[model samples]
Target: MTHGNTSWQEFGQTFVDQSRELNQKVTDEILERTERALVSAKEKIKQTEEVNEILKLRVEKAEQEARDVKALLSRPMREIAEISGDFQKAYEQQQQILANWILSQKAYRETAVQLGIAVGKTAEEVQDLVTQNANAVLENRTEHGNDSNTNPLVKEYASTILAIRKKNGEV
Candidate 1:
């Protein structure tokens, strides 16, 4: 009876140990699967956020394009064509005018520098004269009310030419 009791006690201990081992394995597997699911959910959220931002930009661009189309359609056909044709011609004329103006200004600046050197004046003095002339030209145009173009620089440069010609007794 003593030997049988000892064998029964050993069987009971083995059963308890097997149960504890099985519980640990199940718990570890459940934790690993839960972590994987959480990471997948976070990745999906990040993709959704990126897509949402692109959709907003697309909507803004579409709205702007619609406004532009509406404005174009509202204008008379003949007026639009004439405005476009005149714009092209004006742009070409503006380019030539700018080039000629730049060349003339270069010559004038060079002449002023030479005259300053001849008078034993410093380079800074020459530059000051040029700046003063430019400012005076801009101010004179504002006073005359003879503005034709929208660009202030064009008006100022034209004024400068007139001012220079007047100063030299040519105007």
Candidate 2:
């Protein structure tokens, strides 16, 4: 009876030790797998942050480029507007001069002989003189402007702008 009891106790101890070793192996495997998963998740998050920064820079660059393009496209319109303002100023000044001249008109005798005549022009050439002088004045005022009257690009741009303004009732 004593030998049988000793044999049973030995078997129970062996079983307990084997169960504890199996449980420890399983815990170690689970811990290793959990650490690997955490590292993978952190790597994915870092990659996402890098991609977001790159996209943000690209968007900023695109916005700046868009602003530059807008300024470039509107340059011709700004120049034309400045020229129109100059012409308007000249026209107003000419009108004021005409008003002053009309207030000082003199009735001359019908005998068409003038005592002094400048080379080929007479006092009756007011209309032609007005146009020629106005043009001379404008040319002098814009001495630094593009004065090539035969430049096709300048002519086309001006005509197009004027026509558009006319169509839009802004002329």
Candidate 3:
């Protein structure tokens, strides 16, 4: 009876040890699965944040474009007729200025020829003198301002020619 009792006690201890070992294995598996799930959740969160940043940038760009379009639409537009009228006015003014210049040049040429005749200068000499005077006027006007139609040299020449003609009794 003592031997049988000892055998029964050994069997009970073995059964308890095996149960504890099985519990430890199950606990290890549960811990490993929990760690893997946590890692996956963290990765998903990071991806969601990156996508949100991209969406925010896109929204800002779209809003700016909308504002630019609105501003363009709000400005007043010019009519075709108004623009055409403005162009016509400018053209007419330019034409009038050109006509005045042509008339002045013609008068200057005739007066210069008369002066050449009065002073016994050849036509070619008179033309050269006129060209030199014109060149000087152009240079001075370009350097300073083009506010005057005549220069001092031209005035002096006209006065001298008038005096010469008057003295010769040809005026």
Candidate 4:
């Protein structure tokens, strides 16, 4: 009996030892896996920080470029406004000169007609004299090479009289 009891006690002791060894191995594996996970998490955080810094720098560069473009465009925009104002002034001056010239031409035509009528001639005769005088004026203008009386309106009026006379077989 004593021998059997000692053998059973030895078996029990071996089982306890094996169980402790297995528990220690499992604990070490769990610790190693946890350390690897921590290292991977730290690497991910570092990469994210680097990317954020690069994005910040790019944003700053874009803002600076936008400011530079605005500065460059300002001068041309001001010049365009100044040119538009100058053009308006020149256009107004030309318009006034044209208005005065038209008024003078109208007055001269009316005076010439009145004078012809007061010379004791029939209306038709006076008209013919006026036409002849206008033609002589045009000839003098062309001979003298004067451009002042060669405006489109003056040429149009002369051509109208010439056409009328030709149509009436009075040319």
Off by over 4 Å in 1: 1-6, 78-171
lDDT of 2 at 76: 64
Which candidate order results from sorting by lDDT in descending order? 1, 4, 3, 2
Q: For model 1, how does the per-residue alpha-carbon lDDT over 1-171 read when each residue is reduced to its tens digit?
A: 235556756777778888889888888898899999999999999998999899999999999989986787588654455657765576667668889999998998899899999999887899876665655544554345534244666665776676775687543
TM-score per candidate, chains pooled = 0.40, 0.41, 0.39, 0.39
**Model 3, C-alpha of 81: deviation from truth (Å):** 17
User: What do the candidate models score in CA lDDT, each in turn?
Assistant: 0.74, 0.62, 0.71, 0.72
Write the number of the candidate with greater lDDT, choosing between 2 and 3.
3
Residue-wise lDDT of candidate 2 within 1-171, one digit each (tens)? Answer: 245557767777778888889989999999999999999999999999999999999999999999986775567644544556765576667668877766553222212224224345565664444434434433333344544244565455655554564577543
Number of clashing pairs per prediction, in order: 0, 0, 0, 0
Question: Over the full model, what C-alpha lDDT does candidate 2 score relative to the true structure?
Answer: 0.62
Q: Any residue pairs clashing in model 4, and if so which?
A: none
Instruction: State the lDDT of candidate 3 residue by residue for 35-98, as single tens digits.
Output: 9998999999999999999999999999998997676546543332244576567667767888
Q: Candidate 4 — worst ten consecutive residues by lDDT sum?
A: 139-148
Best by TM-score: 2
- Candidates 1 and 2 compared: the better one by TM-score is 2
**Model 3: which residue pairs collide?**
none
lDDT for model 1: 0.74
Cα deviation of 72 in candidate 3 (Å)?
Answer: 2.3
